[model samples]
Structure formats: C-alpha cells, structure tokens
Target: MGKIVISSNVTLDGVVQDPDGAEGFALGGWFHRFAGSKDLEDWAARETAELLGVDALLLGRRTSEWFESRLRPGGGAEARVSPEWADRMNSIPKYVVSSTPEPPRWNNTTVLNGDAVKEISELERTVAGEILVYGSYQLVRTLLEQNLADELRLVVFPVVLGTGLRIFDETGGKPLRLVDTRQMGDGLAFHTYEFVRG
Candidate 1:
C-alpha cells in the first residue's frame, strides 16, 4: 500500500497560499524570502531527501496546470532547479484529480476523471510506496476529510503571513500522531504527523 504524504511549506500562521508568488496573492512569495539563507538551504536539502523516496505525485487540476506551465521541458522554469531535480519531477508518475475531460499537459501525467476520493483510494491500493502531495490545497482537504491521506509532513517557516488561503480552512478535525520533528537551522521547523485513523 502507498502512504499518501502531504508535504507542504507553510508559514507560521498556517497559510499555504501562493508561496511562490505565482498566483498574485497579497502575501505571496513568502517562501522565497529566505531563498539564499543557510537555514532555507538546509531545509531544502531535507525536502530533496524526502522527495527522493516518493514513488508518485498526486495533484489537483489547477496545480497540475500550474506545474505544466512552469516546470515542463523548455518551459523556461527548468533553469531554476538542478537538472537531476527537474528530471525527477518530469519523470515521476503524476495523477491529477480533474473533473474536466481535457487531459493534463505535463509529462507522465494521468487525469483522474471520476470521483476524487474513489480515484485516490484505488490509487492507494495499487501504489507500493510514498505518494507525495504538494501545493494541492483543495485536494489535500478532500483527502483529509475522506480519510485517505496517511501522513502529513509540514516544513513550517519562521515568518507569519497575516492572511492567506490556509490548508485547513474548511477541514474537519482529524487526530494526528507526531511521528518526527526536525529543526532546520534557526528558521525552519520540519514536522511529520501520521493521521490517527480508527
């Protein structure tokens, strides 16, 4: 069985919106503010290590489109990251939960056209390792609400953005067991929590 892990970079205030400033949110680009810091570099290294173990990626429709636009080969965004990292991202098996019939344009992507919970539940049964979810807020909420996600890995930055779209906005209360915690440098706190399912 695959462990559905939600790996997110959130602010101190639990805001998950527009970390990269791509969406034009008022408080956007909070994540890149610490781009060149030693702490941020350490935190990114840890994230890279975690990503190395991921077998697949689960994404929402909008997030899928966003990645397609920014991360695709010859798309100009590949210049921002290392070749190996870009290759891993491009080659990973991706499943996008989309109601629309239009297929996702990213390489190695498959559109899950039916019910979100059912599609992901079936995916969990077939996948053998970690299925990482990144920047898909709506999909993350659905997974939490439907009891589909297995773990939550949050890299909490030190800064507090006053307001933004939070991941747990409309999510119901779900118990979590702390599995791991790591302080990356002085600014980043990495925490892993396993969902307590009955």
Candidate 2:
C-alpha cells in the first residue's frame, strides 16, 4: 500500500496561499524572498528527494492546471519545478481530481472526476510507493477529513501571513504525531507528522 503524504510551503500562520505570488495575493511571492539562501537550496533538495520518492501524485484541478501549464513542452524553465523534481513529475502518474474535463497537456496525467475519497482510497490500495499531494489544499482537507492521508510534511517558512487561504478548516481536528523536525539555516522549519488514530 502507498502512503498519502500532504506537503506544502506554508507560513508561520498556517497560511498556504500564494507562496510564489503566482496567484496574485497581496503577499504573493513571499516564498521567493528567501530564495537566495543556502538553507532554501538545501530545503529544495530535500523536497526534491521527498517528491521523487512518490510513485503517483494527487492534485486538485487548479493546481494541476498550474503545473501542466508550466511543465508542458517549450514552457519557461523558470516557471517549473527543479530539474530533478521536473523529471520525477513528468514520469510519475498524476491523478487530477476535477469535476470538469481538462485536456492534460503534460505527460502521464490522468483525470479522476469520480468521488475523491473512493478514487484516492482505491489508489492507495494498489500503489506500492508514496502518493503525494503538493499545493492542493482543498484536496488535502478532504483527505484529512476522510482520514486517508498517512503523513503530513510541512516546510514552514519564516514569514507570517496575517491573512490568506489556510489549510486548516473549522472542523479540522485531525490527530497528528510528530515524526521528525529539522531547522534550516534560513529560519525555515521542516516538520514531519504521521496521522494518528485512536
């Protein structure tokens, strides 16, 4: 069985919105402000490794479109993930959860318009490696609500966005056990948490 790992670059305030400023938030591009530090580079390397470990990806419609637009042929390199990350993303099986039909311009992408919980649960049964969800906050919430996610890996940045689209919902009471922690030189905190069930 595969593990459902929820990953993100969030703020101290649990705000996961518009880190790259691509979404046009007022505090957009906040994550880019810390780009030049060696700590960020190391963090990126760690993220790349974690992402490469996944055999499949679960992404929401918007996030999927964002990734597909940048990852398609002849797209600007700056608009995509790192070279290593790109290689893994292109090769892995991507199941996009979207109600609408979208022609995926990227390679190895599949659209799953059925029930989120049922489709993802079925995917977890057959996948031998990790099934990662990155930058898909809505899908993450659904997975957590259904108790389907196995691990939560958060790369928290130093900035605190006072207001933004947060990952935690009002009824978000999922139990998580701390599994790992690493503080980077650039003041970023890397945390790994496993889903806990009574």
Candidate 3:
C-alpha cells in the first residue's frame, strides 16, 4: 500500500489555522511572524524539500479556499515559493477534499467530495510515491478515525495560540509511535509519528 503522509505547521497549542497571515485574524499569522528567523526558514526549506517526495497533495476545503484566494493570484504564500519550488509543485497532482468548491483552478488539481478512504485508496493504487496531506484538520481527523494515515509529520512552532483549530481534537484514543524528533534552531520542533494499529 502507498504511504499517506501528513505534514503541517502547528502552534504549540496545536492550532494550525492561518499560519501565513492570509486571514485577518490577529492570531492567524503566527507561523510567519514568530517563526521567521533564519534558522526557521532553513528548517522549513529542508522540510519542504523532503515533503516534495509526495506524488500528490491532499488538502481540505478551508485550506484550499485560503490558498486559492491568496496564492492563485501569484501573491502571498504563492510568492513565497520560488519558481523552482513552484515548478516542482505544479508537476505534482493535487486532490482537494471539499464539498462546496467549484473545481480547482490550479494546474493538476482534482476536487473530491466523497468518501475519503475510498478516494484516497483509489489514488494510492494509481499514483506513485507518497501522498502528502497538508492543512486539512477535518480531513486529517477523518483519516485518523479511519486509520488511513501512514505517517504524521508536524512542525510545531514555538509560540502558543490560546484558541484556534487544533489537529488532535478527535475523540477516542488512537495510539501512535514516535518515528523521529528534531529541534530546529528557530525553536520549531519536528515530530514524525506512525499510527500504531491494533
């Protein structure tokens, strides 16, 4: 089976929303504001390089909306990715799990609005390399409930958001095994964990 990897930039309190200042929320831009040190940038670049191994990207509706509004115009987060990085991203396929989206405008993107497991399984059979999930709290919750995710990669920033969307809000208990952990100079800690199945 193909591996399903999830990569996210979360706050110390697990908040993952508006890390890039796309939203007007005063609390939304924590990732860039508090974590823009050279050490953090270098670490993020390294992580981005590693995450590029995925054959495709899986995003949730909200994230897709935010990205589309800002990045699609060739500004904000989109601008952050250099031409080289953009070229690499454009080459990979993207699957957006959304119900209200009217198709994706980005190149090589597919909008999915059905059973998450079924769709992801189909993609796994056809796509090469790993399938990476980003900024989809809802999708990630479902994947965890269905026990579909193979690996979880979290980049925890040093700052704390008192309130926001969290990645581990799912009920019940799902066990995980730590595969690796590293501390970057920017005070961001990278944690890789594998779900421990029964």
Candidate 4:
C-alpha cells in the first residue's frame, strides 16, 4: 500500500492559502515575505529534500493549475528554481482530484473523479511509496476527516496572518502521532505527524 502524505508550508496561524502572494487574498503571500533570509533558504532546502523522496504527487485541481501556471517550465517561478528540481517535478506522476470532466493539461497528470475518499483509498492501494500532496487544503481536510492520509509534514513558518484560509479550518478532532520534529532555520519548524488509525 502507498503512503498518502500531505506536505505543505503553513504560517503560525495555520494559514496555507497563498504562500507566493500571487493570489489576491487579503493575507496571502505571508510565506514569501521572508525572501532572501537564511531561514527561508533553509526552508527551501528542506522542501527540496522532501521532493527528492517523493514518488508521486497528489493535488487539487486548483492547486494543480496554480503549479502549471507558476512551476511548469517557462512558468513564472521556473526561472528561480534549479533546472534539476523543475525536471524532477515534471517527470513525476501527478494525480489531480477534480470534479470537472475536462482533463488536466499538465504532463503526466491523471484526474480522479467522484468520491474523493474512495478514489484516494484506491490510489493508496495501487501505488507504492510516497504520494505527496501539496496545497490542497480542502482535500487535505477530507483526507484527515476520513482517516485516509497516512502522514502530514508541515513546514511551519514564523509569521501569523491573524486571519486567512487555514488547513484545519473545519476539520474535526483527529489525533496525530508526532513522527518527527526539527528546526529548519531560525524561524521554521518542520513537523511530521502520522494520523492515528484504528
């Protein structure tokens, strides 16, 4: 069985809305606000390390589209990251959870339609190794609620946005077992939690 891991960067307040600040959310871009800092570089290196071990990627349609626009080759953020990183991202298999009938246009992407939990559970059974999820807040909530996610790796930044879209917004009580915790840089906390499954 595959491990479904939700990996994301969140602020102190749990805000995961828009780290790049490209989105127009009132509190968006709290993540990139610390550009060029030693802490930020540490955080980026940490993310790169995680990506190195990732077998496949699971994302929401919107997040997938966002990556397509900003992380793809020739995209806005493409010029900033290493070419190896970009190539690895493009080579990995991506599964998008979307209700839309139109297929995702990104390379090596598959769309999962209908019944999120069931689809993901089947995905878990079929694929081996780590299936990392990034920036799919709603889908992450569902996975948490339904006990489908195996692990959650959160890179907690220092800033708190007071108010914005949070990852655990409406998620009910679910206990987690801390697998690992470490400080990446001066301000970032890297935590890994495993969902307590019966």
Which candidate wins on lDDT?
1
Which 10-residue span in candidate 4 carries the lowest summed lDDT? 32-41
Global lDDT of each candidate: 0.86, 0.83, 0.78, 0.85
lDDT of 1 by residue, 113-136 (tens): 898888899999999999999888
TM-score of 4: 0.94
Comparing 2 with 3 on TM-score, the higher-scoring candidate is 2
Instruction: Estimate the overall C-alpha local distance difference test score of candidate 4.
Output: 0.85
Summed backbone clashes in each candidate are 0, 1, 0, 0
lDDT by residue for model 2 (35-149), tens: 5577677787888888777789999999988887777677665443588787787798998998886677668888879887899899899998999998988888888788998
Model 2's TM-score against the true structure: 0.93
Which stretches in model 3 have alpha-carbon errors above 4 Å? none
Candidate 3: residue 104 lDDT (0-100): 77
* TM-scores for every predicted model: 0.94, 0.93, 0.87, 0.94
lDDT of 1 at 75: 79
Evaluate candidate 2 by giving its C-alpha RMSD to the native, one decimal: 1.7
Q: Against the true structure, candidate 3 has what lDDT?
A: 0.78
